[model samples]
Target: MGGKSRALPPTRGTLIERLRDPATAPAAYEALVAAYWKPVYAQLRRRLGLGNEDAKDLTQAFFTHVVERGSLARYDRERARFRTWLSRLLESFAANEHARSQAQKRGGGTAHVSIDPESADHRLGASAPVAADEVVESFEREWRRALFEDALEAFRARCVELGKPQRFDLLLRADVTEVPPDGSRPSYRTLATEFGLELTQVTNELHAARRELRACVLDALRARCVDEDDFAHERRALEGSDREIER
Candidate 1:
């Protein structure tokens, strides 16, 4: 099974190494915050029952703590997934903040970490409250959603680079979304007629777009995994029993 699996990229270790290096820390930290802040904010809102303003404040504070305190240096890739490690760190930070009555009232200690309260509110509105025992589950769910969103953005940029923005739009409209909303699928013939193309062209472009999106998703997942084994585990977790990749 292992022999059939694709070789995992070294992005995860490379990112960690960059975070640990003073020369590269600033840029790496920014990337980290961009990649993760949404899930962290969502987790805070769902787990601790925080409002949008407080969640945004705490999200910024968490990243600020990571940068200023060099807390990411304590990450042990051998011990756990980076996601788990960061989640634990966030939980501890929230606990400590709650312990300080003044800090709790003030929202958070860091002012430099800016998050969009409106975006957080929109996300919160889309979901029901998660049970306390299911906070980790909630965090993982949000993380996967964020990861796929990042992949979709990457796919969109690639489509623009390849001069096929229309193809991407078609793929999203026809395959990704349920615009019909009654479980009724759109036909390639109809899409081809709408776009003034042959049915085969619509089919081929949709296939290509799907393949690119899948690759982008895998690339995003590779960036977050601590190692090859961790990558496999996360891929399984994300893809479930439809495991196209071997163990």
Candidate 2:
């Protein structure tokens, strides 16, 4: 509880039915949008480097387009993260930077909510500090990092089931207090103290936890592609936590 839990709490039936039946399920659409909107917008602003106005518009239009355009089906969780594939789509959108405006003009074509383009632009452009490119980069390149996080979540849930969720909590909250000049990773000592464990025990648990998480992430990414080679690259890309594809 030190910081906000960022992972989505598991919701079994409602979200699945909604994702599966977006056409008729009003509740589903809202649920999907609620879960994804921030991440989508976060990708736009933090990785793609869009201005606040453009990012906001992009976020709205992205979800609208996904629902209407029958693109969500393309998101196979097995092969890629919802985030990585999303990053690619976002890149395509960003490459055609002017398209969001035009897409907004066209609207959802189904009496979808009529969002004001100018208002979105104003909101997106509200913050000038973060560049579009930075956000975009974060989206694509975070495959490994995101996967690690997902793995961590999976591990946490697994531990919770085993009645020891707090045991590995510290790894979930790993943070850099001081940057090593050479960019070396922090030692297990810091993590041990934070989680209240002996150094040796902490090291072993960290290894098990990270390994499990890595495996979980790779498993998720593996299900996304038709080609094994592409999947391998995606897994490898996560190693350096760098962008796998150039936009």
Candidate 3:
């Protein structure tokens, strides 16, 4: 998602700003919700290993539990990485799925969900020796995907607000985001012709869009890591985990 778009990338300053006052800005929340969705869904998928429909239901339930139980509101940066804290919460829910099922059968008041603990045990390495490779498929991996999607959503919204909706779409199509490259990408002139915008106007729009996008992306990344240095470390950890699974 961190692709070249002839615009400056996000900086650390803005990331700190958004993290400090997320409720004050819709853009910040958008970036956040986008970022965490993946990790959460990934956790649910691994835990349930259910049919698509069941997985979707449990995913929704997990998110609902997180929000309703004040998960985000009570988050503590000092106590744990976001992933670790959430993993615990997921384990709680999974371990109690049977109890919840009974509650449902009795029609009592509780947000019942079939959250099985065996999957959680597997993820947490509580069971007999399963290769570390087997654990990479857990929800932690989705953190990256969610963060990128949130930033992209914010970028798109910023473009529309600035009356350059089409140009925003062009940014996605013109650049292959999966493998970002260095150097000047396509110019406004090319985008203008392709999207039928005046050259001068495209330049202005691109400039604004790029600036906001950089901020959004960086903030998304920052919210999910320890710091800039930790960001690289977390990525390395992820790489090692993936490689382990491959082997």
Candidate 4:
């Protein structure tokens, strides 16, 4: 995904480098929080069996602790992917918080990330509790969901900037929306009619949108990586995910 097409604008440095720098830390931290807070909150709710309010409070506290304590600086790319490292860090934080028997006040932490527990909870629906063996699996699923969501938003903004908002609309309808009960996607002919475009134009615009979305997703994934090797591993994992989606 990070290979050629750029989804996000260029930043001053890698995620870790920016986080460690006083000048760029705020923006970097904001981006980090936006990307992972949902996944963290989901894990806290599902994996730890915490109530909604508790999950939200602990999510805020965990991120604040990470920022204030400089704990992420200890992450070693050689030891694990940043996703794995962060998940482990969350596990440790939650365990300690439980032991202390006091949840930190929500929105009271130094971290600048926004916590939207209601939205996360809504997305999770009223599913049964996640099994212990599936905690990591569920967390990674939320992570991928968050990654694509951010990329889709970025892609939409890019489309609007290009003065082709209809392109995003078509992509959203044809690909992003849930399939029909019959498992059928809207046909290009149907989209062409709905958007008042030639069938060929529909095809071309969708191709461009998908291409851009792929680039955007890669850029998002790359931002979280520590190095080229880390990016390579993650890109492979993402490609595997893509294949699964295709299947």
Task: Name the candidate that leads on TM-score.
Answer: 4
Clashes of each: 0, 22, 2, 2
Q: Would you give me the overall lDDT of model 4?
A: 0.76
RMSD of model 4 against the true structure: 7.2
Tell me the tens digit of each residue's lDDT in model 4 across 1-247.
1111223435656788888889988888876776677788777766555656666677778889999997988888878888888877877776675544433345344534334686456435535666656666777888898788778888888898999899899999998889868878889999998999999999999999999999989988876675677778889898875244543
Q: On TM-score, who's better, 2 or 4?
A: 4
Give the range where candidate 2 is weakest over 10 consecutive residues by summed lDDT.
1-10
Residue 153 C-alpha lDDT in model 3: 77
* Residue 91 shift from truth in candidate 3, angstroms: 5.2
Q: Write the per-residue lDDT of candidate 2 for residues 156-176, one digit (tens) a residue.
A: 677788786655575565532
How close to the true structure is residue 96 of candidate 4, measured as C-alpha lDDT?
Answer: 76
TM-score of every model versus the real structure: 0.75, 0.51, 0.47, 0.76
lDDT of 3: 0.57
Q: Flag the better candidate by lDDT, 1 or 4.
A: 4
lDDT of 1 by residue, 114-154 (tens): 33676466556645656556766677878888888778878
Ranking under TM-score, best-scoring first?
4, 1, 2, 3
Top candidate (lDDT): 4
Task: State in Å the error of residue 187, model 1.
Answer: 2.8
Candidate 4 displacement at residue 114 in angstroms: 20
